[model samples]
Target: MALRVDGDSPQNFSALFDLRGTADTGELRLTSPIGSTLGLARWSPAEAVLDNGSRTYRFDTAGELIRAATGADIPLDALFSWLAGQDKSVPGWRADLSQVDAGRINAWRDSPLPRAELRVIFDTP
Candidate 1:
C-alpha cells in the first residue's frame, strides 16, 4: 500500500486495515498532514461489500448481484460523479477532480465497483 499527495510522493504516511476476520473484509483509513482523509477503501470479499465514508457510499461487489442491487449497470464515471455531487452539501468538504490522474481514473473505470476518491478540506473555526 502507498500514499501520494497532489500526485507527488507523500512524506508522511499511516494506515489501518484488518484482514483477519472470516468475512475477508478490511478498512483502510489514511490521513494526511493537513488533517484530510486522503483515502478510505473497504471491502468484504465474502459478501462482496464495498464502502467509502468520504463519499457516503455503500455498494456490493457480488458479481451480477451488484447490478441487481442497483437495478442498473452503473459506470465508474457515474459513481465518481455521484460522489463529487455529494461534496456540495458538505460545508468544508471539497474535491479536486483535476488532481485525479489518468491511471487512477482508468483503474476505477475498469473495475465493477471501484474505490472512490475523497479530498477533504478543513475550514477554520
Candidate 2:
C-alpha cells in the first residue's frame, strides 16, 4: 500500500503487509524489506490495537486503527472482498478487478484529498 498526503502535512510510505485472519478479526504485520518489523495491527470484535514494539495504541474500530497508523482511512472490509475477487465498492475508492485471474489487484482512493493506492499480489493455488 502507498499512502500520500497532498497538503501541508505531506507524508508518504509504502510497506509490504503480512496479513492474516478473517474479515471480522485479524492481524496485519507490516515490515521493511530487510525483515525489520514496522508495526502490528490486531483487531477483534471488542477492539482494535496497533503495536509498534515500543508503544501500543488502541482504537474503537479497525478503520480507526488503520487510519492512525497510515494517515488514511482504508476500508478493511472492502479490501478483503477485493482480494477475494468480490468487486466490493468502497466509497472514495475505485478497484481494478481486471487482473484478479492473474492473482493481482489494484485499488485507488482519488478523492477527499491525500490520494492513496493499494496493490495486492497473491500466490495462485
TM-score of each: 0.26, 0.88
Residue 80, candidate 2: Cα error in Å is 0.3
- RMSD values for the candidates in order, in angstroms, are 15.2, 1.7
Which residue runs of candidate 1 sit more than 4 Å off their true CA positions?
1-23, 46-54, 62-125
lDDT of 1 by residue, 1-125 (tens): 22222223223223432222221344434555566665444546544443433344455543333343233233322323433432222222234334233222111122232322222222212
The regions of model 2 sitting more than 4 angstroms off are none
Locate the minimum summed-lDDT window of 10 residues in model 2: 1-10
The sequence of per-residue lDDT tens digits that candidate 2 reaches over residues 1-125 is 55555556777777777888865899999888788899999998899999998999999889889888878778899988887889998789999989988988888888877777777776645
How far off is residue 6 in model 2, in Å? 3.0
- Give the local distance difference test score of model 2: 0.82
